[model samples]
Target: MNLPGHFHQAQYPKRARWFMAIVWALITVKCGVVWWAMPHWNMPTHPIWVVGPTLIFATLVTILWLAHREE
Candidate 1:
């Protein structure tokens, strides 16, 4: 059986796209720093606990953004 999907043509503003890209890049860099520094610090919490969600969300958003059609 084929299910109907709602597909709307949307255009993301250039400024917004650039802003999001910068934000995502910053988050990724922060995560990387945390990953590297976790071993040096005597922190109780694991690095994954702090960085995993951010990375996952950023990755998902990036993927969705890339998949979007710009026309």
Candidate 2:
């Protein structure tokens, strides 16, 4: 027995799941990069400065990718 038809229209959950997956992947990859860079990070005086912009760039790219797909 089926319920109301409108219940199936909310696609927010699907998008949310995708968004969460992307976030997790991004975090995991980002951590890996930082881990690999740990030695250089210790040597460079301005290392934190480098990672900040890179993270912003990567996040924007992921945002664009997801936004276009959902449309």
Candidate 3:
């Protein structure tokens, strides 16, 4: 889909796509770390409170990046 005035991966060079992929991977790793450490830290709230939003944001961005067209 074409989204006016929005940033899309296709609008960027191949190098940028790679960079974005790396950034997303790092974010995933961060979520994983937070998930694993949450129990050990004995936090009152569940890990999902923190990791859930990050994952959702990342997934939405990634989907938009892939779905966007260069119209």
Highest TM-score: which candidate?
3
Estimated TM-score per prediction? 0.61, 0.41, 0.71
Superposition error at 41 for model 3 (Å): 1.3
Report the C-alpha lDDT of model 1 over 26-53, residue by residue, as the tens digit: 9989999998888778788889988999
Candidate topping lDDT: 3
What overall lDDT goes with each candidate model? 0.76, 0.61, 0.83
Residue 30 of candidate 1: its Cα lDDT?
98
Q: Order of all candidates by TM-score, from best down to worst?
A: 3, 1, 2
- Report the number of backbone clashes for model 2: 0
Q: After superposition on all CA atoms, how large is the RMSD of candidate 3?
A: 4.6
